[model samples]
Target: MSYGWLDDDTTISTDLKTTKETPFYEPIVNNFETGGYNPSVSYHYNPDVTQYHYGVRHPMKPFRLMLTDHLVIAYKLYEQMDIYKPRRATKEELLEFHSDDYVKFLETVTPENATKLAQTLKKFNIGDDCPVFDGMYDYCQIYAGASLDASRKLISGMSDIAINWSGGLHHAKKHEPSGFCYVNDIVLSILDLLRVHPRVLYIDIDLHHGDGVQEAFYLTDRVMTVSFHKYNGEFFPGTGNHDETGLSKGKHFTLNVPLQDGIDDESYTRLFKSIMEPVIANFKPTAIVQQCGADSLGCDRLGCFNLNIKAHGECVKFIKSFGIPMLVVGGGGYTPRNVSRLWCYETGIMTNMKLNHKLPDELPFRNFFQPDYSLHPNLGDRLDNKNTKKYLENLKNQLLENLRYMKGAPSVAMQEIPPDLQNLTTDEEQAIIDKLNSESSYDEYLENERYWINEKDQARKHELVE
Candidate 1:
């Protein structure tokens, strides 16, 4: 009767602004010069760009923007709750997952080496799906940093969950890159967590199999790689068969649920609930790594399945029910506008955070796509589909079968205490507090000290002598 894990308290008013006048007039009128000023004034701005519009010519552009928008929305909503803030990942953290040679190669890739590297596509698999772009290294670093920060949060116990929507580059290999992923952030984060927890479960529900991550931990019992993806025959990188369990100590550790194409939401939910719940319950993993790829949705150019956004939300909510300190990563999604909405909605569902649903007065993609209170026009209707019950049944059946195949492993629960909390001294805490205060003071100082570009512009000068 009730949905997976979410309660009725989850719903919120879809309105972005409480009232029309409140959105436009309040911020401007409350300027410091007016007595209605607040102690501190800060405004968050979203950029409007031509490339991010719905029908942008570039293939990756829209998807990239979609990821950004979802993250921005999540940031704003959580800012009100004061839940979690994103931070950059450090270099030391990156080395935990990436090979030294591969890391160095990424750093050295430039205009000169890029052309030469393009010639060596077979060697690195760089040109195939993961092409060497102009700023490929920078983007990899940024993604690596975000993934690292997420790991840090988990390790520090700052939050029970930390998600980097940009970080799940699952298809990237240790030495060779593939499938639009350069350095595998998922792998990196897993390795970082391994230092703290002996066992980790990585569950990927992307349409394409998580070949890179599965390969990295193929022989290790410490990590379990479970992926449910479309396996219609060597689709892209071509790995992850149900029979390909782990080697040696990793036997039965790697689980693959390769589904046929045209699979719908109901089937997905059944399979997820039945298989994942029992398997995870039996294994009793110390932490969870979930990759929520929007490509699994219907109409996504790259994906093969036909799952709706609600099904995706259901999966996230189910995962959150485990209540473990988990690191969530974003993976594939080609349909930019829809994917962004899907991810934004998923974030709220997983974190138990509410959506404002208010349209930012000037969204970056405003001119390109019409804005409705709901992220998508088709998804606006609240009516439940007739096929939902049947789909749920199908999903439950698939999950039941998959669970039978899984063998329960011994539960090794590692108590992980985050390094930040363990290491911070009273003096360190005071220093951080003082630093924040100093930064705020400096901001106030800069705001008050205004500079005139041209002194003449400040005072109108009319030469009567002329």
Candidate 2:
């Protein structure tokens, strides 16, 4: 049951050789003083994630985040950016998206007592893709917390770009887990953004459909969910259909461009710009959440898309160009080595610097991207490019036709559901506040994080800022 070779330190580095031996690992401090400016970017990463295992040689390696984090550091990305090791998310915060019963099950169920609650496990699909391993709850909480923190930062106007390699668990449903996701961190993050921004756009570039996020807001126009994914019905989770637009008040608010397998970069970028240009112009969202899942790349173990690292990062650049406050998070990248490379490259994209790809041998996990010892190695069109220009064109044509239905924004009033409700994910503190206030005070009782209306993370920025 142990898969130490995949995650253990001994297997990864036998000689305990330090990065000091390698020239690339030597950090080059980039001073904005030279250029008179550095873009405001914040990154949330937790190294403790690598300790939890899914009990087999699985694709969802938590250590992938660690590799990406270190790769960013090796390239000295941390110096240009504001980075923080975030705190684990709270049960109450998680309740924003997950059901109370599901939250309770996750908090109380242990590997020892997991079999005792077989019904719960079965209901949530908490085996195989998502397993009931030791510290599974903590694993979910820690990563989910980082994403929530990032969203808060964006909402506070503190960071123009916030990155969380620990997040974008976009497939988990409200009542149960699905796909490899247990907690739908993207959903939770989007829900938090909904509090401040009148309209929020959720975009998933993962190979798989962003089912959980789409489902969570399928009935509301407040959030417009757009996903570009390989949507074969038989594929995992299998739900992002083109016609599965939002319902009732949320009609035309959802867009799914289902591409075929082996879609190359040129085809992808064209479709991305074509679809996204209109969606952004029409929906006019005030804020955005992007799921940058590296699994969409060509050489991925499970994915069939032919996007290169630069192609994957280009989507981020395009979104950033809109000048909207954005939260960028990682999702399904099965091939861990490629995941590291893709994310590291994207980190540079966020900081607006093209990093040196001629990686020295001293980099940790350098062997993963072998043969040509380069950061941006040409993975090339390894998949047969099953998608032709016509197929991609047809897909684009269909999406354009669909967007024709999305003219006027939804006019549904924001539901005034109490923060604490029956059979709901209720905030306990909110209940106490409701009880403490008198009728007059209750009439003027302001909800949401009022104290943080003008607050920000005390950013420990560069000496130049001093």
Q: Per-residue alpha-carbon lDDT of model 2 for 1-466, expressed as tens digits?
A: 4532212233445453643443333222345533433458999988898888876776788888878877888777787788888888888888877889899988988889988888888887778778888898999999998998898788777898899988988889988888778888898888787776789999999999988899899998899999999887988777888989989878888899888888888888878988998899888888899999888998888988888888888888788777788899999998888898888888887787666666644478777767876677676678788788888788788888878888855444556642421223347666766777765465565433443342433434542321
Question: Tens digit of lDDT per residue, candidate 1, span 75-153?
Answer: 3544422233344444455566767777677777765677766555566666545655565666676666666667766
lDDT of 2 at 71: 87
Residue 363's lDDT in candidate 1: 53
Winner by lDDT: 2
The window of 10 residues in a row where model 2 has the poorest summed lDDT is 3-12
Which sections of candidate 1 miss by over 4 Å? 1-18, 21-58, 62-67, 70-75, 80-92, 117-121, 354-362, 367-373, 376-407, 411-466
- Candidates in order have lDDT scores of 0.65, 0.81
